[model samples]
Target: MPFAVYVLGLAVFAQGTSEFMLSGLVSSIAADLGVPLSAAGLLTSAFAVGMVIGAPLMALFSRTWPRRRALLFFLAVFVAVHIAGALTPGYGVLLATRFVGAIANAGFWAVALTAAVAMVPDRLKGRATAVVVGGVTIACVVGVPAGAVLGERWGWRAAFWAVAAVSLPAFLAILRSVPGGPRPEAVPAPVSVRDELRVLTGPRLRPTLLTMALVQGATFCAFSYLEPLLTRATGLGAARVPAALALFGAGAFLGVTAAGRYAERWPTAFVTYGMAALALGWSALALTAARPLAVLALIPLLGMLAFGTGTALITRVLALAPGAPTLAGAFSTSAFNLGAAVGPWAGGLALDAGLGHRAPVWVSAVLMASALAVAGVRRADGTVSGVRVT
Candidate 1:
């Protein structure tokens, strides 16, 4: 892989930190901002919602611009929004900042994935995607837990400040490293919106998108509520939450690293077994919520399966949609974010119903099972059957 691909991963690490770090800071944010816990949770969903909306839109708008220019622009917006969020006094303004930051984050992601893939050969695309996605897993391992610690020691806003501070270097690195020009010869850039739309709506790609969405939804439904579950049900102290999160992150890193090896050669079996294992992990977590040791044991295994499967599914999307890299990136980004948005909201609904944190784990198990079903199904031609979005 090119050094520039790693630079793009560095950029993703900075931005992806902001995406997952909020789960750890939710309680502090809720307390400081004088909002209900439920409302503070919306901040996560708000960012996800923006990503779901912004991925394709930002990808389309920036398609004509040089890749370097588009990346820098998005990172600039992301840094600005984080700074604004850190300084905001009102919950509504902070909420708005999360949404804006996500749009910027989504734009960065859509472009970065395309750029990363463009730098490599077709056989290496899966590893390239893993390299980029590995940044996110690394963020979970380092950045998210660090943000939690910052929130615990200073305030929730400190976490936001830290994100902006760390992201600036990534912005500068990307400005220096990524080349400016038309799309590389390895991939063809879309010429028009209609052309991209036609490729996006193709029969082979939609089921991959659906499966990606469901896998992400299942993983995050349990993840978004992990802090609460650990503290309330598993009897862990607040100080231990970051460590637990770190263990999960470590598992995620390992998972992505391991799965990337087989993603290209055995995409179907990788996704199927990964999803089945993840569903079982969630079921086990729900069943053992009261046992601290059991909960800890399961966290990393679950994290491993969750991100491992995610990496494979995304690799599959890139393979299937080679003609439309930018839109393909956008669609994959949108699919995952769509799930990220709904998972938290659905988990919140479980809490609202007085079902407790364990309910969300059960919810995740069900969602993962559905994803397994999708991954397991195939047409007579041995292709994954695609579903139309409309």
Candidate 2:
């Protein structure tokens, strides 16, 4: 892979950390500012909401800009949001800052990915894309957990401030490292709902979107409450949640790396089985009260199954999309965030219903199984190729 992939990875890591760290420190943030934990928790929701809004909206808006400028501009926005998050005083202000931040986050991904895919040669696109996504996976493994520790030590506000500091360097890395990407030579497409709708309505997109939405969606089911769930299982105090989160992240990293290596060769059948296994794992998490042992043993598998499917599913979509890889890529990311919205909201509802902590995990497990079913129907033998539009 080209060195630009690494720079992309770094920017991803910084953005991802900003996005997820709030989940771990929600209680602290709420207490510090005299708000309810639930209110504080909205930070995560804020980011997801941002992703949902930003994914399609930003994708449309960015069609005309030079890709490098778009990338840098969004990263700067991502950094500035973290600053706003750090410095903003009231709950309402914080919420507004995060919502705006999501806009930038969404745009950064849209443009970065559009650039990342275009920066590479055709044959290497799949692998190159994987390398870039690997940053998000790595962030899952490290960024959230590390941010948790930082929040715990320096305060949640401080954690956001630290991430804000990273933007400066990340921006520079983009200026120096990322290739003079495809924005220059490319003819900008006319942005229209009809254009995007036509892409979604295409034949092969059906199964591809289904596969990602379900499989990826299921992880959030378990992920949303992982901090508390594991804390109960492990019998650890709050301070230890970051370490557990880190372990889960490690599984994500390993799984993503393994996906790039074996997705081409295997039937990818095991990923569904992997989801089944994740369901069973969450079931174990639900059934056992020995929270410490269960979480330590089981949580990482959720990430493993989730990360492993990424390459297989993405390559499948790119193959399915044929001529419209950028739209397909944005759509895939859009689907993931859509799942992101569903996962936490589902978990939160379960928690609010007095269903006990494990309810969300179990429900998500079933969702994963559903995703597996969708994927199981896909003909692995029929490699979906990209469509070329004149």
The number of the candidate with the highest lDDT is 1
Report the lDDT tens digits of candidate 1 across residue range 1-390.
788888888888988899988877889989888899989988887888999999999998888778999999999999999999999889999999999999999998998888888878887888888889999999988988788889989998899999999988888888888898776532463456776677778666777789899889988888888989999999999889878988899999888887777778877778888988988889999999999999999999999999999988888887777678568899999998898878877887899999987999999998988886765563322443344221
Q: If scored against the real structure, what TM-score would every candidate get?
A: 0.92, 0.87
Which 10 residues in a row give candidate 1 its minimum summed lDDT? 381-390
Candidate 1 clashing pairs, residues 3+ apart or interchain: none
List per-prediction Cα lDDT, in the order shown: 0.86, 0.72
- Tell me the tens digit of each residue's lDDT in model 2 across 147-218: 877888889888888788777887898888776545553456544556556776665577668767776677
Candidate 2, pairs of clashing residues:
141-249, 233-291, 233-292, 234-291, 234-292, 319-384, 322-386, 322-387, 323-387
Root mean square deviation (Cα) for candidate 1: 3.2
lDDT of model 1 at residue 102?
94
